[model samples]
Target: MYIAFALVLLFIGAEGLVRGSSSLALRAGLSRLMVGLTIVAFGTSSPELVVSVEAALSNQGDISVGNVVGSNIFNIAVILGITALVCPIPVHRQVIKVDAPVALGVALLLVLLLFNQTLSRFEGVLLFSGIVAYTWMSFILARREASPASADNEDILAVTQSRHWGMDIAFILAGLAVLVVGSRLLVEHAVALAGSFGISEAVIGLTIVAAGTSMPELATSLVAAFRKQPDIAIGNIVGSNIFNVLGILGVASVISPMEAPGISALDYGVMIMFSVLLIPLLYTGRRLHRVEGGVLLALYFGYLFLLWPE
Candidate 1:
């Protein structure tokens, strides 16, 4: 019951956020794709941020790493796959050339760091700095490439329709509040339920907790797909994955230095494989088709198989 209720809040939050952020971006003369990659992406990734930070502070640093890796894997496999299944999502040119590949590189970086047996505070600083740089570069690009003329022309209609800065801010804040509450509820109840059933610890962490932290991404992407905003949908996924590695892990490591570090090599490989798989999937016909979505979903189930026995 709690899980169902949390899902409802997630949907409502995601809907409000998508409309608010997308509209705000459009009003600021930014394209939906750019807005998705920036504002929506950051907003939706907040749940992962919270989970990782808490795990780090509690000395359960492996959970921090697992949460991030697992969430990123889920974001690509389940979330993106489902979104594409709902509606074929167009791969923006910038995404193919820039964001998607950046995500791959970030995943690779995480794997390398894990193999080193520690994510030291210095390394954490480096990882955190990368996101800062990426966000700054993104803003500059958005300003230069966005079409202000569209916003100007739409302004009259927006005013007549009562869409303004105040309303956009309200939507964003309200969405954030709902997302935090929903994520917390879902994670708590899921962990409890899994424990009650004697489910494998690995399954609970990699599935329930990972999925819970990724609810915001799931919600935002699903909503974007439903609204026929393919660019925004894909952008939110790719961007959130990048933030998962660079932003969340970085912050978590800096906070606690992540001492519990035993991520399986196979698990790391799977994460990288999924990240790289996006390139070919998106490159083929320049969009994620339903068939590819099925393939991703299959790969995710395969990943779950690996975790189940471990």
Candidate 2:
């Protein structure tokens, strides 16, 4: 019952988070692409961020790593899968040329860091810095590309001033607070549920917990796809992947340096392979057609099959 309630809260909080953040971004004069890339991406990833922090503080480092890695896989395969099935996601050239490679690079870096059996404070700092730099660069590029014909910043400011920024901020804060508390409840119940079934925490995080947190991504991507805003949809996924790898893991490691568990290697391998497999679709004319979406979905199902207990 607690788990079910938490799931309900999670969905509600995610909806509020997305709408609130997107509205705030627009009110602040951000372009649609920038809103999609930064605000939307960060908002959708809040669940993963909260879960990873909680898992690290609780000393469940394996769950921390598993959550981020598994969420990324689900973000690409499942979220994008169902989104594409609804409406084909047209890949933007910038995503294919810039974002995809960066995501792949980050995945490889994660693998290399774990190869040494731990992600130290130094490595964490490096990863965190990379994330900051990437974000700064993305914002700069967005500003450069923004058209002069775009909506006036004064109009944006007027809209923001007309509304209660304080109220919106409060709503966002309250929603996030609820989400954090709810994530704890969900994770705790999930762990108990998994133990009763004699399932490993890693496996539970990989399947159930990962999928639960990824609901935001699934919802956002599907909505974006149906609206014919494929660039936003794809950008949201790519940005979330980067944040999951670098931001979530980096901060968690700094809080509690993760020692590579026995299961880490398999998880890392899957993450890298998944990122690699995306290269062709991302680069081929900068569009993920229905065929590419089908391939990605099939691969994800195959991965799930492999994860099942023998």
lDDT top scorer? 2
| Backbone clashes (count) for model 1 | 0
Q: 20-40 in candidate 1: lDDT tens per residue?
A: 776777787765545656766
- Among the numbered candidates, top TM-score falls to 2
Q: What C-alpha lDDT, on a 0 to 100 scale, does residue 10 get in candidate 2?
A: 76
lDDT of 1: 0.75
lDDT of each: 0.75, 0.77
**Model 1 off-target regions past 4 Å?**
1-34, 147-202
lDDT of 1 at 57: 73
C-alpha lDDT (0 to 100) for residue 164 of candidate 1: 77
Tell me the TM-score of each prediction against the true structure.
Answer: 0.81, 0.90
Candidate 2, residues 229-298: lDDT per residue as tens digits?
Answer: 5556788889999989888888878877776473456677887887887778767776677877887889
